[model samples]
Target: MIDNSVRTLFLLKHSPYPPMGGAPLRNWQNIKAMMQLGEVAVFSVSSYKSPRSREYPPGVSLWKDYSTGDILKERSLIRKISDRLWWMRLYGYPEADQFYGDRVAQELQRLLVEFAPNIVVFEEIWLYRYLKIIKPYGCCLIYDAHNIEKSLRRDISVSEHKPPFVSSLSGIKTAIIEGYLVQQVDQIWVCSQQEAHLLQKLYRQIPPTHIVANGVNIADYHSDRISHSLPTDGLEPNHFTAIFTATFSYYPNSVAAQILIGQIYPQLRKFYPNCRLILAGHSPTPYMKESAQEDSGIIVTGKASDIRPYLTAASVVIVPLLKGGGTRLKILEAFAAHRPVVSTTKGAEGLNVRDGEHLLIRDKVEDIVAGVCQLWSDSSLGRKLAESAYKLVQQEYSSTAVRQQVEQAVLQLLPSDFRF
Candidate 1:
């Protein structure tokens, strides 16, 4: 039987199930937490046209939107051209997702009437256009600000100077959209205190914003010992291994890998000649694969079914990300596995971790080299940092810890007399 009390309708940009780390993991945890408050239903867009998988929270409902192919087949050339022109004029770039079609809007409208939720929560700001449609229902609106979208785009532009014009325009478009949404929503949920402060400063008129930190399901990653794997090359078992993991589809992760292979690894190898590097994640670029072929010690494991094995096999985990926003789930995963980590300042942004205490934070080439060398050389230090990091993750970044904060934030958005 469905719970009649405190129904919430979620609008998501992507499905949370079969969590692939990053935004999906965060969304899955948030939705899981929302179920504790009351019944929840999710409406999301599929990035591709794959067979739908049913792996959501128990008792919660899910409705998926179509991929681009489904829409383009029905869309007329003139209409498409007109949309492109309109997008260019208004947002200074052609953003296809913003104005997809009436089909999605109609579907959302139908679901809204049927579900009749007391609270309508959106995962990201991209879905704000549908906000107006939910207004007549009198449900409280909540915006889960994953990251300040404008700031993220601006940061990318500053870090990687490619497509500067599009990035600048996209940043402006995001700012305009975010500014409007912040005022309209009843409350906003940010991932970190840094994000909360940034949003408040950027939009002073912003409504009550709550800090709901990103977290991991600790049980999924805890491993007692590093999994043993035979050395593929002439390298011995004693070779120091450092692993960097992330979906390479994201631009920042790819850049981070390049930096790791090109700069950080070289420096570290000078101090420890037997040091090996592992790039593990989905969709490894051609360059990454080619680089791996060039160096026998550099191993690229593209799209592993179980990242835990790859993570477990490593002596140290490194995040050399030069750009990106929000707290990193990868770092939290490493901590959950009780693995020592070395990361850049930007890589550790928004995380409740301290430099030299829980994880090593180093930005410069020399510092990163030194950090990795120290972690690999000093077994005692590695164990100490890993233990402290695991405790921190359990206490602060565990699902239970984050869910309570989420629940409180959602409760505050409801009427004082509202009951579940």
Candidate 2:
């Protein structure tokens, strides 16, 4: 029998809203779908604000806040280290700030006693500290691990200096604590198999982890939409265009940008005279900004209210990302729009894509140039790749697959007596 009673669910995250990458988008989309089942309360944090953050579904309840400015500005070594220790206690590694200060932890304890939930989904591992507050309430706990945090951390450690190793004592301590957190979750909802395998090898001996690849919101990422608001620093669709968008400040993104502009783009332009690569994202540094100025072929547009215009206009969407974990939602977004992709093997690591069938893969700069030239010269090939990519998303990576996974994960975790 199905129970339609409004079963409350609590969601927690290490970061705040209007999700950028896979984690936040999944968070947002999950919340929207779960509301159809019953009532939901999202306990989340964000350091920044945007108009989009305020846009929540009709019945969705929120316990989210803007990240603390004071928490971010703490520069004193003694205090920072102290906060990190305190923060890491909450998770394995400390986030910017703890969600429940001394009072809130007590408040959550009190609330659990009051509005008991059927399920509780922790958006990231950091909030797993609240497990005690949750588990005792007899509610299901779903750890929506956006990525396998520990392995992803290790990958970042070597790929670039961003997620650098913690050094001797701290590194050992971090690994020990992180491994334990994954073990406690009732069910871990992971993004990719590569990440799941890394976690299972590190911690679990049995019981398979769930693989829920991130999805693209094909409805919002529409075609034929141009932003009249954008200043349009003289961009045209007529040229042979290549587009990539991400929070460029990210480690893999910065690394990929440097390599693409520094090495690959030059060779790409040599063969195809009219080609231009657009670096479209938020907060592009001075070096990235200059790439467009120096090369008429390379245009860097810093932040767009709606990136669909750039995606819709481009002939190719290139993801040269060399580091990171989980499916590149950026690639999925482009694929959703039927844009042909040219990526490094590492960039297209997990999304269940083919080398030459769904996408054209290249590790060498010369090969990258050849791939681009091939797409540029052959209009038929570009359309074929684009059509094939879109079909891939529709068949396997749709929002329907994502929402169904959440439903089953929640059902498996919840107590049988609980109604939803």
Candidate 3:
């Protein structure tokens, strides 16, 4: 059923192989879906070094992979300063322009000529700057929006107590950029219906928008498939463990970690003295590490090769996110691992999960603590929630379900005579 005539190229802000974080994981899934539609070539930029060997699909090719270090190494001091200043003046942040420069543009132009892709997928709005380079090639453009950038930026800035003027300026610039990108792309893909509506509300003249919800590979997190070799240093089988997993470097996750360590865990420990909390992810801030050192009950795993073990060891998974955009994959992963979940409303945003049905949704620290304790005391309730959540994920958020959604979206972009 593959369309041999279609050539699809992905322009990503980060490398998707060995997908550890949300953005990379989403990109990885999208790539896999595209591979089913046609031949795929990826041109990605990453902050980290490329893996020596990536397990890419048989026919797919990583045409260009550049590290931020690789891109910066060749630039002179004067050029770097000029570029930063220019980007700041226009966009209020340099990230949008980070992957765009004469060198990258020329290489992209060459790629367009040689690959001659029929469809070009922009992984996120950050890569929208490269749209001009691909437009001349007359390829169908698809913008996969990971988050509603303007709204997320505004919310994060306000939560972090950034100056009002500065936050407003940044938000305005983001809206302008995102608005243009949405209009320019042939089709737009968002994480949820909530995001789709937000986009419609924000911009008047947007192209067709589709909801492509975030999902997990169910088999990866299945209890029978995972081995329980909990990676952290100190843990006993008797302890009631509450775990929160995320890329801790992200602003919302960092805030949630601080809240868990400073507020929630302390309160929960008083009720159940044997309670232990695990903050498992990459790039724990210095404060989080120090807190872990001070509290024996808290274990901070800086980065793990696999997160499945931690999920398997958990008595319950907690998400105390205060501000963030898009649906959370952490909750889905927890459900897939057959663990009960307690998430804040913001933490569980964009998911079609009901409070107390799939997972308990709580906003306040005390309430979240109570929810965790409830799960610990009543084993049957936890089992019920986990079972319901597992069923929900299988029906809607599994890899197979998401792949079908992506396939349908892509089919709509093809010519009327074309068939998949």
Number of backbone clashes in candidate 1: 0
Per-candidate Cα lDDT values, in order, are 0.79, 0.68, 0.83
Q: Which regions in candidate 2 have their CA more than 4 angstroms from the true location?
A: 1-17, 48-59, 70-81, 84-92, 96-100, 103-115, 162-174, 206-208, 224-231, 416-420
lDDT tens digits, residue span 228-311, model 3: 555545765754999999888788899999999989999998989878898888889899899988988888887776888988
State the local distance difference test value for candidate 2: 0.68
TM per model? Answer: 0.90, 0.85, 0.93
What overall lDDT, based on C-alpha atoms, would model 3 receive against the true structure?
0.83
Which lDDT value does model 3 have at 376? Answer: 93
Q: Is candidate 1 or candidate 3 better by lDDT?
A: 3
Most lDDT-accurate candidate: 3
Candidate that would win on TM-score: 3
lDDT of 1 at 288: 93
Model 1 vs. true fold: TM: 0.90
Candidate 1 lDDT over residue span 1-420, tens digit each: 544478888887666566664777788888888888777888875555322346654567655555545556666777678666754555323343443556877888888888888888877777766776889889889989888977887877786666867666778887887887888889999988899999988888788889888888888775543344433343345538899989887778989898888988888888888788988887788989999999977889876656777777688999988887855888998999888999999999988889878999999877888888998779999999999999999999999999989888977887766666
At residue 158, give the lDDT of candidate 2: 74
